[model samples]
Every structure is written in C-alpha cells, then in structure tokens.
Target: MAEIRVDKLHKAFGDFVAVRESDFTVRDGDFFCLLGPSGCGKTTTMRMIAGLELPTSGRILLDGEDVTFRRASHRDIAFVFQLFALYPHMNVRANIAFPLKAQGMPRGEIRTRVEEVARILRIAPLLDLPVSGLSSGDRQRVALGRAIVRQPKAFMMDEPLGALDAEFRELMCGELRALHDRLRATTVYVTHDQLEAMSMADTIAIMNEGVIEQVGTPRTVYEQPASLFVADFVGSPAMNFIPFRAALAEGAAEVRIDDVAVPVPPLREAVEDSELVLGVRPEHIELTDPNEAAPLRARVFGVEYMGTTQIVTLNPAGGGTLKARVSSELAVRAGDNVGLHLRPERLSVFRKRDGRALKSRLHEVPHG
Candidate 1:
C-alpha cells in the first residue's frame, strides 16, 4: 500500500479553472473518497492522480516519491471506470486473468490467481460464463476482480457503481467495504452520491465548483459542517435555513423571524448586527401541541409516509416552509395546525455574508 499526496494541485481549461489549489493526503491503506456533485472537479482530481490528466500546477506523490509527470502505466495504479468495460468475448475467468496474462505470469499461476479472485468476490460459480451473458451486478464484480488480480499499489475508482440499479448499488457499497478490509489496499473513490461516500469511505473530501469545501469523517461532516454550503448539501432532506435579525431580550440574545421573537444564545458582540441564517435539520425539529402558548405555530402543508418515518412539511405562520421528520405513529395531515419546537443545541447559526457557522455564538446548554 502507498500513501498518496497532492500538493497545491491545479487544473484549468483555457479561462475555466476546473480544479483549484487542492492539498490533501490520503493515508496509506486508507479508503478515501472524493465526493461532490457533477462538474465539481472530483473526477478531474481523480484523473490527475491516476496520471490520466496532468495538472497545471502542483505535484503528485506516491510513497514519498514525486510522480507529478509520470504516465498512467508507470504509476502502478489500477483504475475502475463507471462502465463495466469488460471484453464481450471473454469469460469471467479469462477476464479476471487478463491483467496477469499481460504481465506474462505463468499459465499455472494465472489459473491459481483467477480462482482466488473469483472466490473472494463470490463469483466462483460464474467463472466460465461469457461477459455478454453476465448480469449487471456480476459484470461489475468482473471489473472489480480485474482490478484486484493486479495487486496494484492503490485502487482508483471513478463512480464504479453509478451504472448499477439502486438496490445493487446498496449491496455493492457493503461489499466494497468488506473487500477493503480483506485487502487493506489504498483506495481513492470518486462519486457524486453522498450516501455512497458516507457508507464506504474512511475519510471524505466534499468538493464544490472545483473547490474543496470540507474534508472529514462522514459523521463529522454531517454533524459539524464548516460552511452553509456544506450544511445544506450533505444531508438527505437538506437543512432548513431561516433568516433572522438579532435583538436583545432580558440581557440574552434573540432573533426575530417572521415577526416572532424567538430566544437564542448570545452572539459574539462583533457579529450581533450581521444578518444571520438559522440552520436546523428536519430530523431535529419536533411536533408539539398547536396552541397560542406554543412558541411557534405552523399549518401542515403536506405529509409523506415513508416506511419507518414520516416527513411533515409545514408553512409556518410567519412565512416560508419547514420540514420535520417524525415517527409514523404521529398522526398528522395537511391543513392541521401544529406547534413547532426547535432543538436548540442541534441548531446551527451562520453569518449570511459568507455562510460560515457562528461557532463562537453556540452554547452547550440543555434543551427543555
């Protein structure tokens, strides 16, 4: 296994900069994922690391050696593309042995390696099936088997599961994690799916518009996003952002939203007057009694009954929409007036000017 590093990496096309000065290190034997939306430079960054695309500036290193200008074949890396890319005429065994055969391994050793890979991927039964006859999931396994047989320094995959159906993709995610544990090979995966990255990666770098917004473990990025862009992008239902203006109530800080003065912790005096955006995840908001004494009130606009949980969309009395995730047992319907309760500790406040979290303004107080 090799530790991969990219320092001050940059890529541009004429006037368009596809990647900024990116700097990060993928530890040896680490399952690192580059995650973001389309055109976010994740694939471009992967291409550079694979030696498929050269960077305009910066160096690429493997195992402490500078390989900035090395050719793809010289990088000692295995690449699995989004498409299966298997030879239509070759059977599973032949396809899995192709790399070893190209490297001129002995006939006997190639057979041994092919059987070993097939067994590992649980495709031993399909070893003799032609690629044209294999199912999509099996074809994906063949592609992975091809990569595994080579025993390359690191595996670089670019959306390898994108072509699979949702159910197959979900299964593959778990299998990939298991395979990583078995081989412990360094892996750099690039994908636009947040769930895929969150499920399989030991570390994830979130990219946006060619810039890396945040890099952390799945839980860390989900819980403590560094910027509003990250907070809004990484969640399933996305975070609910409401605008508020600050005020002082009983020597404590308060924010006025839709003419309702809701109490909040004190902000740093410097940013007291800055326009603020209150961010709360749908799962954190709870349903309460709909009464005049309730701090906030809203009318249910819609309800979606998911298998285990229901999503309730409400149009608050003030304006705008808020969504809450609650138990399916909670009977709610459209046009039903309900009270809303914000989980104070779970709330995030950001400066509207730059959409950065107001970490200094947060408190650790218990919620009522």
Candidate 2:
C-alpha cells in the first residue's frame, strides 16, 4: 500500500484548461474519493494519476517516488473504469486471471490468485460464465475482481456503479465498502455521486471546475462546508439558503426575514456584515404547532411522504418555497399552516461576498 500525492497538477488541451494547479494527498491504505459533477476534471485527474493522461505541468508521486512520467504499466496500480471494459470472449475466471497471465505467472499461481479473488468477491460460482451474459452488478464485481487479483499497491475506480439500477447501485456500494475493509489497499475512487463518496470514502476531495474545493472527512465537509458549492452538493434536497440582512436585535445578533427576527449562532469571529446569507438543512427545520408563535410560519405547498419521513414543501408565511423534513404522522396536508423552529446556533453563516461559511466549530445536534 502506498500514499499518492499530486502537487501543482495542471492539465490543458491546446487553448483549454481541463485541470488547474491542483494538489491533494491520498493516505496509505485509505479510501480517497475525487468527487464532482461531469466535465469537472475528476476523470482527467484520475487518468493523470494513473499515468494515462500526462499533466501539462506538475508532479505525481507514489510512495514518495516520482511516477509523473512513468507509463501506466510501469506504475504498480490497477484501475477499474466506469464502463466495464471486459473482454467479451473471456470467461469470468479467465478475465480475472488475465493480469496474472500478462505478468507471465505460472498456471498454478494464476489459478490460485484467480480463485482467491473470486471467493473474496463471492463470485466463485460465476467463473464459468462468459462476460456478455452477466448482469450489470455481476459485471462490476468481475471488473473489481480483476483489479484486486494482482493485489496492486493502489486501486483506482471511476464511477464503477453508473451502469446499475438504483437498487443494485446501493448493493454494490455495500459490497465495495466491505471488500475495501478487507483489502485495505490505498484506493482512489472517482465519482460524481455525492452519496457514494459520503458512504465509501475515508477522505473526500470535493472538486469544482478542476480545482479542489475542500479535503476532509465526510462529517466535517457535510456539516461545515467550506463554500456554497459543497453545501449545495453534499445534502439531500439541498440545504436551504435565504439571503437576508443581519443586525443586532435586543441583545442578540440576528437575521431578519421580512417581519421576523431570528438570532444568529455564536461564531468564532464577529461577523463582518449587516447583510448575509443563511443556510439551514431540511432536517434541521422542525414542524411546530400552527398556533405557536415561532419566528417563521410556513404554509405547506406540497408533501412527499417518503417511508421514514415526509418532505413538506413550504411557502413562508411571508413567501418563498423551503423544504422541511417532518415525521409521516405529523398529519399535515398541502395548504396547511405550519410553524417553524430551529436551534439558532445550528444556523450557518456565509459571507455575502463569496458564500464561504464563517469559521465556527458547531456543537453537534443531539440525535433524536
């Protein structure tokens, strides 16, 4: 297992810049994910790391050795692409053993390696099947099986679940996570799927427009996003942002929405503005009694009763749609009036100039 380091990486095509001066580290034996939307240079970055795409400038290091100019074969790594690039004619067992054969291993060693990986992936029974006849989920396991058969120093997987249905994707995620726990290889996974990154990665590198926005554990990045882009991408239904002005009301610093005044959370530094943006998660918005005089009152505009909770869309008593997650038994219908309450300190403050969260250590919300 080895740590991977990218320093001042730059990739360009003629006049276009695909990746900027990017830098990050994937710890030894850690599951690191490069996450972003499509055409955001995540693939380019991964290809560069794998020695498939040469950077316009900058160095790539594996275990403190420079492999920036090394050919893909010279670097000890295995890559599982988003598209399952399996050989159509090969049986599952042969496909898994192909890498070993390429290395000129004895037949006895190859069989042992292939059977070991097949058993690890629980695909030992499917070895005789041709690649073309397998389900998308099964095909994915074959691709991963091939990568791990050699026990490469580092593994790179790029959206290996894109071809599967939602149900299968969720199942594959669990399988990959468990497989990762056992292999403990230094792995770099690339995916635009935020949920996948959150669930599988030990460290997430959230990227946008080719530059890394933040690098941290899932919890820190989710609860305290460094910028507006991350806050919007990491959560379900997204965090609600209501632009408003800030001020001192009575003895507390507060944000004013129409006629309502709600106190701002305690911060590490005094805020620089009388005007700011407020960010709150849907789950943080609680449904209160209609008669309770909360700072804000919303009229339910629609309700999506998902199994465990309902996402109630609301138009503030003043106006503007905001989503709040409530219990299914709350018994609210479209057009019902619902009072809103929140832990004021849980509120996130972003600068009006650039939309970065103020540096504050939040007290964890007591799980209900």
Candidate 3:
C-alpha cells in the first residue's frame, strides 16, 4: 500500500531550475529508478521526495497521505547515499542498530532487528568487524543494513553501487535485485548508469537537463524511445544517428541515406519531403560482401573484439561513420571494404528540426 505519487513537482534555487514540473508514480513495492546523467536533477528530485529539499510547487503523496512539507524524519523513508556514510568508530552491528537506538527501541529489540538485516544482506559473518576494516562492498552492505533495519515504507538509494569495482558492482546488482524480491520494499534508486538501471529497475524515468525525457519499462524505452535524446542515451555504444532525407516511395514513407531508399515505419503524421535523422542501433545493421548489390559501401576503419561479440566501425563512402556489432567469427578486419544493409524494420525516424522521434517500428520488427 506504500504507493508514492508526485504531482507537478518543481524545484528551483535562485534562478536555476533543478527540477521542472515533474509528475510520476512509484507503484506499491515497485523497484523504480530515476536514471540520468550528472546534474540532470535526478538526485534533486529524490531529495524532494525524502523531504531533504523543499519543493517550489507540487504535491507529494505517500499511501494517499499528503506530506509535501513534512520533515525527513516524519516521512519514515530511509536513504542510502552514494558514499558509504558509515561511522568508522562503530562495528557493523552498532552501525545497523544506530537508527533503532535513536528511536529509543530496547536493546534486545535493536539487536534482533540488526541481526535480521545482517542475515538478509549476507553480512552476518562481519557483524562484529569495525566499519574501518571493511572493504568497499562490505561497507555498502552495512550502509544498506542500517537503512533496512527500520523497515521503512520505501528505500531511497542514490548510486549505492557507484564506488565498487566493475566486477563487484555487477555482483551487487544481482544481490540487490534478489533482496528486493524478498522484501518487496517500495524502492527509488537513483543512478546515471543505464546498464544498472536497465538490469534492476521495474520502471525507469530517464531525466535530462531538469526535465524527464521518458518513462517506461526497460524494454519500452530501449526499443521505442520517444526522443532523440532517449534513443541515444539508453543504449550501449549508443544508437547511430545519421542525417537523411524523407520521401514517399510506392505509398510508403521512405528515407534516403547515401542514395539508399530505405523503407521506414509509418510516421505519426506525414511530412513534406524534408531532412530527417535515421536512428538505428549498431547490432541491428548487417555487414555484407562489397561485391554484393547492397545500397551502402564502407571501409572497415576499426574492429573491436569483445569476447562475446565484435564491434566493427566503418567509414561509409557516402558520409558519416557507422558502427556495426557483429560476431567474433566474422572475418572482417580493418581496411576491408564491406557492404552495409539497413534492416528497415529496425529503423527509427526523427524530425531533423527538433530531434523528436516521428516513428518507431519496435513492435513490428524482430529482434534478438
């Protein structure tokens, strides 16, 4: 029943708008993520929800109760910060029990709750270890322990995994997801990493420059981005954006890139022949032999051999550079001339003037 609804929330400091007319809902027990790059107002938005920052104009409702002006302590929400804000003088057990002790809970009750959280986080073995002696990952676990010991209505984690190494961060991502499944605690996690957000969040709100760009499940945002900013930001290696001209061919909307008349999905509305941006992910493009009749020709300028797959960079003869992710087994090398084919169904078209997506064929196209 701990659903959070934000209605037209706005925050401003001096002349700068940190957050702008934001409205979103985090469903009961849902793992929601506020995702965006630095200074994008994600952390600012979370601070407003936690009552750490006052709103300029908006309503914040938790479980049907209005709490816009409530103090942080009164909201009963726990915050796990980006830095492991642990007390170096205290042991793990003491750190986890601090919040309960602050509430005047009995010693016996505090001990019980601390141990329970320690077990859940799999840090029971290190309960007696001083926070100073712990590793980065362990310190993060202890910080989480302190937040969960109180069993707050919702958990607000701001880049809790940012300090850990890459391998350990991946491991923690799985552990955190599993813990969410068990607790089902309404969680608002803030992070700039799209991979982390995509892997963990049940719902994602992508933000940029004091505005929310898009909000949806990971697949929805990745496959059918609403704007050029979203389509470029959400994918790894980023989506390839190339300038093209739109036209009508045989009653279907089409775009020409390097004289290649590629059919595109139907637009929301037709436009006069004009410049448009063609958006496609590297993985969706196929590489072929130069001798073939493919519409595009390119020289392989670079090849990246990722263990699982290879990324091939090409300089198209017509213009801009293109990247294609292919299998490691593909015998492509630098300096090799290749034919490039656009998977028309996988393309996205955007109006060149404003960089807004005009059409997406995500549902109609087949993807791996």
Predicted structure with the largest lDDT when compared to the true one? 3
Q: Give the per-residue lDDT of model 3 (tens digit) for 125-148.
A: 999989998888999999999999
Predicted model with the maximum TM-score: 3
How much is the lDDT of residue 89 in candidate 1?
88
lDDT of 1 by residue, 1-368 (tens): 89999999999999999999999999999999999889999999999999999999999999999998999989999999899889998899999999899999999999988899899999999999898988888999999999999989999999999999999999999999999999999999999999999899999999988988888888777876767988888988888889876633333466677777655556554455668888888998889866536778999999999979999999988889998999999988899999988876577777888878775344333333
Cα-based TM-score, every candidate = 0.91, 0.92, 0.94
Model 3 lowest lDDT segment of ten = 246-255
Off by over 4 Å in 2: 247-253, 363-368
Which scores greater on TM-score, model 2 or model 3? Answer: 3
lDDT (C-alpha, whole model) for all candidates: 0.87, 0.87, 0.89
Error (Å) of candidate 3 at residue 81 is 0.6
- Pairs with steric clashes in candidate 1: none
Better of 1 and 3 by lDDT: 3
**Angstrom error at residue 146, model 1:** 0.7
Better of 1 and 2 by lDDT: 1
What lDDT tens digits, residue by residue, belong to model 2 across residues 172-222?
999999999998889999999999999999999988988888898888788
